[model samples]
Target: MNGPAQLADLLGMASVQRAGVALLVGSVGLPVIGVVIVGLDIIPVRFAMMHVALLGAAIGMLTGLDPALCGLVACAVAGAGISPLARTPESLSGAMGLLMSLAIAAALLVLSIAGVNASAAFSLLWGSILAVRVQDVLVLAALAVVVPALFWWRRRDLALLLHDRELALVSGVPVRRLTLVLLVLVAVAVAGGIRLTGALLVDALTLLPALAARRLGHSLTAIICWAIGIGITVNLIGFLVALALDLPPGPVLVLAAGAAALAAHLIPERRNTSWHASVH
Candidate 1:
């Protein structure tokens, strides 16, 4: 058939509908968390949580439990456990590096010992958007709403915290508790993203949009708004394009996000170069 007819038929599938819902929620939510991550300079935590999620998925597969639940739990625990080290960027990086190594090593061991099928393990690595379920959509939807609401409610405090930890503490921002809470939230968000897009490409939904938004926006609220807008645009375009081309949505989405981010970065530089030449 025709391209539009083929896409319509694909969209008619329940699995595709569920995947679309999950993607929609992710496109809206992950970027908000990304702002906090980037502001806190906790980028490494995302990589560490991804590995932890993989390990959790491995154990879940070995024991016949829900991999997503296991991964979320693992991430929460890791988040709380590592929160104490978040006082400094250097310490956070070191701790996250150690956690990433341990998590990957343990995941490999579990997969090897259980002799899990390569496809099963690969699913954890790359995700299967078409296989997303109703429960997954509900979980993602709830997180999408709750995370943004929390960020909005705490916007002022978070702004202070992002500005300076010492100033936030002096301003009674509950730095320790806030840091712990944010880390756990970040962990849960990462786990959710991984369930939909996999570890390798979760950043497409989370970081890239926020990074692009950062380049375009001068304030936290502006950054978040820009990120959400970019996220929705890229995700919808990528999902539809993938459907049209019979390609995997996850990688296509990543490429779309990357292209947007690259454009966001380069366009301003080009403008600045042109202005400089005009001035000279």
Candidate 2:
């Protein structure tokens, strides 16, 4: 999914870059989680994570939302009637919250109405890395391109809105429209990433790189570079280790991300560097 233009965009859009990193990590993280569960002698991680991932992916694709977004909506709305949208216009967020809640309710109702096998539905939640097909990779690649580019194309506004919605509004940043688009975008990216990593671990990919970037670098560009580098390392290494050891990839990827985060914390950061600009 990633190409030259998008790579260039990563130089600017921190959020999109962050999601790109998550994409890389989740692509491997889900399988790693499965391996960890197996190693710990817990229940078959595959069944739970796999089913959940599949269900989330299916729902997302069906609804034209990213599968990752679908899971977030379903889980979050099911738990609380919230949109997971903040740092933006409240009105737009409120609308998103309502829509997400309604959508999830519709999905659940459909599942209930169709009398679908709960077990089958669960597969979307947690998925199998061992069985990951080329199609999955292609889908992820496409999302990797679309997700990051979309955010990058609008990064300045997104940064302003997230860090300071009021200021952004006053500055003519289309706060309401931006908020709605961002809310939906976040949902979609999360849903797509979750397909590879599983919901439990997808957040790691989404959040970890940004967190690491906060500490290690000065410019947003530098941070994104580190974030993507960290993500790539985790995904590639985790997958290989899992394959060699006959382990699941999802939990392993999470562990890898965690380890990278810990290392970032422990490592000496660049001397005398400062955070260039706050999100606002």
Candidate 3:
């Protein structure tokens, strides 16, 4: 069959449809969350949550429970536990490092004790979009709505907080409480992204687009719009290209996002340099 036919057949499968919806939701939601994450300089928290999710998945495998649910709960707990430490960049970094180490070690211990197959463990790390369940799609869909709604509702506070936490606090923005809420939201979102794209490449949907959009946009709102637009574009292209090439979508998606970020970074520099030379 031709590539389009093959893609159509794949899309016809219920599982693939679920996977596509999950990705679509993620493409929209993750970037909005990424704005807060990038603004607050809390990138380490996402990495820590990824490891916690893996530990949760390991425990689920041992206990015969749904790994996705276990992972989500684990991430939420970790996010809450670490919220107090988010008072400063240094504390947050140190706490995240400690959490990552502990989570990964615990995950290894659980896997070894249970004699879980390496492939099963590896699945949590690499993810398989084709294996996405309906529940996963629903969770992503809900988050897609809730996160953007929260951002819209709290736009003023978030804007102030992102600009400068101390300034936000001075303006009576309830920095600590808002930070805690954002962290929890980020944790849950990261877990959902992991379910679709795996721990290692969730950033393709989350961070990379935000980073690329930053290059293209000057204001917070503009950056967010660009991030969402970039995320949707890359995700769709990557999914279709993966279908065409008979490849895994996760890595291809990452590559596409990375390429977009690279172009976003370099193109502006080249344009500026050309402009400078012409002026000189």
Candidate 4:
């Protein structure tokens, strides 16, 4: 009887371990997918556009129209800069330099004229998604669905563009039209995710999974699926941790991503010792 009771207890402990492992695996999937969608141009908007003065645009959209459309405006601004500034490599580092300057100047001007609170403007630009409401989740869920679905409907065109823009255009992939669509999709994700993660770190949300997927993902499709799973899991777990620690969700989420990246790197190679044939 004693031995049977001990065995049952051990089995229960094993079950717990299995559950814990599943949760961790799921958490690892969140940022991976979010980043992949961004890389795939499923979400063109980055937290990049949540500038001081841009709050007015978002505010207007929030009040009347859809927040995603407002984000599209910002994405357009980013798109305009990308080819001329960000893609230049030489100019990329400083691309935000002038824009930041202009944005600051404009923000100051608005402050003088409209008397918007400095903190409010800053908050809108940065955002706080730590303790989000259901409404926020709904909006994010919708964008998550719409943006990815659109990309799926036209994955070939996007793949071509990413692989080689000139080739895509030559192949009659409607490069300009699709590029515009992709940028808009990004804006939607950026705007939606900003409520939780803030503006500056949007790239991290979109990039982390891509980094992981690149390592574990054998093919593009597999990479994206795995990436989304990572993004969603990290986000949920990070939010919970942020709640527990009384920390900022944005930074907490980023820290989670960094940890996962480190773990991925630290993970041991599975090659057997017997197979250690050093050709070098």
Candidate 5:
């Protein structure tokens, strides 16, 4: 069959395929939020979430439960734990490192106890979008709405916090509250996103678009908008391409996003020479 014909067949092949594609579209929203937060220097938080997700999956496997649901709970708890540490300059990176080490070690231990092979454990980290359950889709769809809504409603506050937390505090914004809230939201969104790109490649979906968008956009709002557009486009096109090529979706999607980010450099950066001259 031709490309379009093949894609149509994939979509219509089975209920599971249609469900997976639907989930893919919904889950892309998580990466949309990820790009915005990652651009604000919260990349470590996302990484930590991935570790927690792995641990969650291990626990689920050991207990014969749903790994994805367990992962969602683990993500939330880790977010709460990491929030305070994120505020302390001396502890931020250290705490994340500690959590990452512990989480990975615990995951391995649990997998061993459960008699699950290393490859199976590792598969959780890579994920299989085609294997997502209906419940996973529902969770992702809710996060898709909630995460972007929170960011959109508090765009200015988040921008201020990202620009300078101290300044935001001095300006009477609730820095700690907002920071914690954002972290929690990030955790949830990332947990949902792991279903699509897996823990390892989530950044490819999130950061690459933000990085590329920042190169082309003059403002934070513009960057976020462009990132969302880029993210959706990359996921959709990547999914179709993967279907056509009979390849894995996660890596293909990431590579596509990376290519777009690379292409972004071709757009010449705007220099504020006049403003600098005036200031000088």
Candidate 6:
């Protein structure tokens, strides 16, 4: 087959592959949003969650539980634990650092005791997008729907919290509750992305698009929409390219996102008179 034909054939893959691609698209959307507004705090949390995921996978292997589910639950629990600590800058850094270290050490210990292969224990570092199951797709679809809807419905409040939590609380915005909700959603998004892009590359789906969008958008809402668009575009392109080239999807997807970010950075910034007004 020629290049176009080969690409078409790749796109016209089996039902499972199609579902996996769809799952990737759905799984990536919300985390990119988190990356956009939640700021640098999310970076450490992402790292912590990855370590927690490894521990969860090791434990799952030992217990004969589904590793993916176990990893998701563990990440969610870590998010819950980190949420309160994340309220302040000092505590946030300390918490994520502590958790990341502890989780990785525990995971290594568990893997050793369980006699799990090191490569298998670290499988989440590479991911297997083409192997996603129908059940995983269903979960991704629900998350795709629910997360965006929640963000949309609570856009104003979320905006307030993102802008300044102290101000939001003073304005009676239930800061702690909202922060917890956001953290939980982040956990879910990170865990799902890990399954498709792996723990190491989840930022391709979450962070790069947000960074690219930051270059183009004058306001948070605009950035969010652009981030979601960029994320979905990069995901589809990356998946297709990986399929055609018979390469690892995780790294390919990350590189694609990086390319987009670089391209965005190359565009000269234009001053918008209305930016401040709109953002406020």
- List the candidates ranked by TM-score, beginning with the highest: 3, 1, 6, 5, 4, 2
Q: For candidate 6, write residues 173-275 as lDDT tens digits.
A: 8777877777777777777777776777877877788888878877666767788888888878877777678787778888998999899999998774332
Better of 4 and 6 by TM-score: 6
Candidate 2 per-residue lDDT, tens place, 71-150, comes to 64554332232223334344433544455455555656656665655555556656555444454555556555654554
Please, what is the TM-score per model? 0.89, 0.61, 0.90, 0.65, 0.86, 0.87
Model 1 Cα lDDT, one tens digit per residue, 1-280: 2298888999998888889889998888888888878888888877899889888888898999988788888998998998898787678778899999999899889999889874676576567778777877877787789877876887777777866777778888888888888888889888888877877888888999998987887666777789999998998899988999999888999999999999999865422221112111
Q: Give the poorly placed runs of model 3, Cα more than 4 Å off.
A: 112-119, 267-280
Model 4: per-residue Cα lDDT over 76-149, one tens digit each: 55645543443323353354455556656665565556554566446555655533444555555556566556
* lDDT of candidates 1 onward, in order: 0.82, 0.50, 0.83, 0.52, 0.72, 0.73
Q: Which candidate has the highest TM-score of all?
A: 3
At residue 148, candidate 4 shows an lDDT of 56
Q: What's the lDDT for candidate 3?
A: 0.83
Q: Name the candidate, 2 or 6, with the larger TM-score value.
A: 6
Residue 205 Cα positional deviation in candidate 3, in Å, after optimal superposition: 0.5
- Model 4: number of clashes? 21
Give Cα distance to truth, residue 210, candidate 5, Å: 1.4
Error of 1 at 111 (Å): 4.4
Candidates 1 and 4 compared by lDDT, better number: 1
Q: Summarize candidate 5's per-residue lDDT along 110-212 as a digit string, tens digits.
A: 8889998767656766766787767777877776677667667776676666666666677777777877777677787777777767887777666788778
Query: Per-residue lDDT of 160-232 in model 3, one digit per residue for the tens?
Result: 7877777778889988898888888888988888887888888888999998987886556667789999999
Q: Which candidate is the best by lDDT?
A: 3
Considering lDDT, where higher is better, how would the candidates rank from best to worst?
3, 1, 6, 5, 4, 2
Q: At residue 5, what lDDT does model 3 achieve?
A: 79
